[model samples]
Target: MKSKKILVWFRNDLRLHDNEMLVEAIAKSDDILPVYIFDPRNFQLTPQYTYRSGVIRAKFLLDSIADLRKSFQRLGGNLLVLTGYPEEILPVLVERYDIAEVYHHREVAHEETKVSADVEDCLWKLRINLRHFIGHTLYNKEDLPFPIKDIPDGFAQFKKKTERDAIVKACFLTPEVIAFVAIEEWGDLPAVEEIVSAEAMIGEVHQELIGGEEEGLKHLNALLEEGSTIYQKSTVKGATGKSGFSSRLSAWLALGCLSPRMVYWLVKDAEETFGTNPHFSQILLGLLWRDYFRFMFKKHGQHFFNDYAMKPERLFSEDREKLLFEEWKNGTTGNEYVDNYMAELNTSGFIPHAARLLLSTYLIYVLKIDWIKGAAYFEEKSIDYAPANNWCNWAIVAGGGKNTGTIKSAFDLDKQFKLLNLVVYKQ
Candidate 1:
C-alpha cells in the first residue's frame, strides 16, 4: 500500500502545543510535511504607505518561524519555509510530495479568507483536501451558545450568555515525535531587509519581546509567577514610564506561538493554586473579547473594514486631513498623553490596552480623523496585530459595529489621564 502523506500549512497557528491540526495530521498520515509560506502580500505597504507588516512585527514573525522550525527539527522533522503565494505554491508541493491533504487553521478576516479560498480552489483542481481547524479562540466556535449569526453584538451580552452556556475545550497534547517526509532543502528564513525596504526598516525594533514558543512559554510562566497581586494593581513601570499592566503575551498569542486554550487553562490553574483575584478574571475576560471580535468578523464579513459606516461630516480639506493624520502618526499631535502613547507604539510596536483605547478614542472622537485609517496604521505597525481584534476594536471605537453604544466616550483626555494616574512627558 502507498504511504499516506499530509502537508501541515503553518499560518498564524505556529506553535506545537495545543495544536489540533498538527496532532490530527500526525494521527492520520504516514508522514507529514510542515510548511510556512512567506506570502509577499503580507509584507507590502498599506494604502497610507505604512509598512503593512512593519520591521518590528516582521522580524518577530521570522523569529517565530525559525523557532517553530527548530521545534520540528527536535521532533526529527523539518518545516519547509517558502516565499510565495500559498495558492500557487501549495499545488506544486502537493504534486511533488504526493500530499494527500493540506491542513491549516481557518481565518475570519476578508483578505485571509480570500487567500484560503484561492488555495482551496487550486487544491480542488488537483483533487486534494485543504482541511481547516479552529484553534485561535479561547472558546471553540462549535461549542458556542449561539450560532455565528446569532451571537450577541454587545460583548457584555455575549460574555454573559457564553460564560453561562459555553465551556472551553481541553488543549490537544503535543506529539512526542513527528515522522516527516525527507526533502532536499528546507528553505532559509529571510531577514528583515529581504522582507521589507530600507526605509521600512528604519524604525526601532522592539527588543523586549522575542518571538518563539520557548520564549512565549517562558513569558507565560513568569506572568503566572507574579501571581494576582501585580495583576490586580494593573499598572506597571514600562519602557514608557507608568504604562498600564499587561501579560505582554499578545505578540506570542497573535503569532500562535502561544495557544489561547493553554493560556486559559494555565490561568485557571493558577487561580485555583493561588487565591482568586478579580484581575485574573479580567485576564479571562480579555480572551473572551478576543473570541467575540473573531466571531463578529465571521458574522459581519467585510463590514468592519467599511469606512462609510462611521463616516463623519468633513472636518477639514483632504490635505489638512492628511496633515492631521501625519501629525498623529509621527507623535506630533501636541496632546501630551496621546503623543506619548504614539511615541511608545512607534518605538516599541506595543502599547497597553487602555492606552490603545484612549488613543483610538482620541483619534476618532477628538482628532476627527477617519477610524479606518487609524486601524490601517495599526495593521502596519502593531506587533500584536490580529486582524479581527485590531480592525474590529477600531470599528467599535468609531461606533460602527453592532456594539456601538457599549464603548463609553473617551474624548476627555484630562479626565482619563487623571483617572489612570498616567504622567505625561513634558518637552
Candidate 2:
C-alpha cells in the first residue's frame, strides 16, 4: 500500500477548529504539510497609494499565524511559515514533499481569486490537484436558496429568502492529532516592521485584541456569558463615543481565527441557555451580511470595486479633492463626529460599525470625495478588513452597487447620524 502525502495551504482560514480543508486533508493523507505564505504583494501600496495593509493589521496577521503554528504543534504537527508568493512557492513545496494534492479554502475577492487561479495553474504543471473548500461563511453557498447569478441584489431580499430556506451547517470537528512531513526548518515568523512601512507603523497598535484561535474562542465564550444587556449597552455606547464595546469578533473572523458557523452554534447555545436576545439576532444578522457581501463579490467580481451605478459627478479639482481626502484621513475635516471617528480608526485600526457608516456617509455624500479612495484607505488601515465586506459596503454607501435597493439613501448623512443618536454635523 502506498502512503498519500497532501499539502494544506493556509490563507485567511487560519484555525484548527471548523476547518474543512484541514479535516479533509487529515482524513485522506498519510502525512500532511501545512503552510502559510506571506505574499509581499499584499504589503505593497494600493493603486490609491495607501499601504495595502497597514502595520497594525500586518502585526495582527503575524500573530494569528504564530498562534496557528502553536496549535499545529500541540496537535503533533507543524505549520510551515514562509514569506513569498504562493503561486511560485507552492509548486516547489508540492514537489519536495511528494504531495499528491493541495487543499485550501476558496476566496471571493478579485485579487485573492486571482492568486488562487495562479496557484492552481502552477500546480497543474506539476499534475497535482489543488482542491478548494468553502468554509468562510456561516451558510455554505450550496445551501443558499438561490444560485450565485440569481442571488438577490438587495440584502433584504437575500436575507428574507436565505433565512427562510437555508440552514447553517454544523462545524467540522477539530482534529486531535495530525501527521506532518519532516522538515528541518518550519520558518521564523517575521516582525511587524518587516511586513509594513515605517509610516504605517506610526499609529497606536490595537493591543487589546490579540490574534489567534485560542484568543478568538475565548472572546466568543466571554461575549456569550456577558449576556444581552451588557452587549446592547456596550454597542450603544460604542456608537455614542462612550467606549469601544462592540463584540470586536470581526478581527478574529476576518482572519479565519474564528469560524462563523462556530459563532452561530455557540450563539444558539447561548440563546437556549439564557433565552432569546435581540443582540444575539444582531450578531447572526452580521454573519449573514458577511456572507451576503462575499457572495455579492463572487457574483459581481471586480464590479464591486467599481462605481457600478455611476455616481453623480463631483466638481472639485484633483488638488482640491486630495486636500479634502487628507483632511478626512487625518480626522481634521472640521465635522466633530466624523473627525472623532476617523481619529479612532487611524489610531486603533478599528471603529464600531456605526462609526463606519457615519464616516462613509460623510466621505461620500457630504465631502463628495471618491468612495473608492475611502475604500482604499480602509483596505490600508482596518485590522479587520475583509475585501468583500469593505469594498461592497463602500459601494453600497456610494449608491453605486446592486445593494442600492437594500439601503435606499444609505449615505444620507442626517438620517444616519440621527439613527445613531448622534447630532448631525454642520459643515
Candidate 3:
C-alpha cells in the first residue's frame, strides 16, 4: 500500500477546526500539504473594467492567508503560497510533490465555477482524485427541499421554505491532525502596493480581524463568555451594541476561519442553557438570511449580479440616472442619511444592513442612480460583500424596470429624519 499525499487547498475556508475538507483529507493521507495561492487574477480588474475585489478586502484576504500560514506552521504544516493561476501552479505542484489527491471546499459562484472547472481539467491530466466539500454555508445545498433550479423566487418564500421544512440537521466535522510537511520558507506577505494601486484603500484593516482556528475559537469563546445571549438587542442598536450580541463573526465566516454550524450550535446551546431570548432569535434570523442568499446564487447563476429580477423584470436602468450616482459615491448626496452611510462604508468597509438598505433605496428611488454603480462600489469596499446579496438587493430596490411592489417605497427624507432623530442639514 502506497502512502497518500493529499493537497488541501485553502481558499476562503482558511481555518482548521470543523473543516470538512481537511477532515476528509487527513483521514486518507499521512503526507498532507496545505496550500493557499495568492491568485494575482483575483486581485486584478477584468477587461470589463470592474474590479474583482476591492483594495481593503484584498489587503484583508492576504492578511488572513498570512495569519493562517503562521498558525499552520505552529501545527506542523506549511502553507504553500504561490503567485499566478491555480491551474498553472497546481499542476506543477502535483508533478513536483507527487500529490495523489486534492481537496477543497465547494464554491458555486460564477468565478469560482470557472476556477473549479479549470482545476478539474488540470487534475484530470494528473489522474489525482479531486474532492470538494460543502464547507461554507449554514445549510447544505444537497439537503435542501428542491434542486437549485427550483429555489424560490423571493427571499421571504425561500427562507420560509427552508426554515419550515428543508432545513438540514446541522453537523460539525472535526479535522484529523496530520504531521506537517517541510516546505520552503516563504517571504513576508504582499503589501497593498504589490496587489493593488489605490492609496486610499491601503491599510492594515485586519490587524484586529485575526485569522485561523485558534484565533477564531478565542473570539468565539470571548463572545460566548461575554454572553452570546445578547446579540439581538445589540444588533438592533447598530454600531454601538453590535459586538455585544451580533457575534461580529462575519469576517471569520467570510474567511472560513469559523464554521457557520459552530456558531449555530453555540447559539442553540445558549438558548438551551439561558432560555429563549428575542435577541438570540434575531441573530439566528440574520444567519438564515445569509444562507438564503447563498442558496440564491447557486440557483440564479450570474443573473444574480445583473439588474434583472428572478421574475424576468429589468429592475434598474443605467441611462435613466447618471449625475445622482456621482453625488452618492462622492458622499455629497445632500441626503444626510445616505451620506452618513456612505461615510461608514468608505471608512470601515462595513455598513449595518439597515443602513445599506436605506442608502441603496436613496440611490435608486430618490436620487435615481443606476443600482449597478452602487453595487459596484460595494463590491470594491466590503470585506463581507457577497455578490448575491449586493446585486439582488439593489435590483429589488431599483424596481425591476416595470416598477414591481418588491421595490421599497421611496423614503420621505423628513420621515427618515424623525425615525433616525437626524437633524436637518439645510443645504
* Separate clash counts for every candidate: 0, 0, 6
| List of clashing residue pairs for candidate 1 | none
Task: For residues 82-110, write the lDDT of model 2, one tens digit per residue.
Answer: 99999999999988878899999999998
Q: Please rank every candidate by TM-score, starting with the best.
A: 2, 1, 3
- Error (Å) of candidate 2 at residue 355 is 0.4
Q: Tell me the lDDT of candidate 1.
A: 0.83
What's each prediction's TM-score? 0.93, 0.93, 0.83
Best by the lDDT measure: 2
Query: Model 3, 1-427: lDDT tens per residue?
Result: 7677888888888876667788777878878888887787776665434566766677667767877777776766668876779888888888788888888877767787789789989899888767888878778887788788888766667678888776645555554456655567754667767777574354434334454556677777666665643333223232232333445566667778778888788878877877777656765776776776677677766655444533432334755345556667667777666676676666666666666666765655455455666777777777666656566566656555223433433223344335444443311
lDDT: worst 10-residue window of model 3: 232-241
lDDT of 3: 0.67
TM-score of 1: 0.93
lDDT of each: 0.83, 0.84, 0.67
Cα RMSD, each candidate:
3.8, 2.7, 5.0
Report lDDT (Cα) of residue 20, candidate 2: 92
- Model 2 ranges with Cα > 4 A deviation: 232-245, 304-312, 409-413, 417-427
Itemize residue pairs with steric clashes in candidate 3.
76-180, 231-245, 314-400, 314-401, 315-400, 315-401
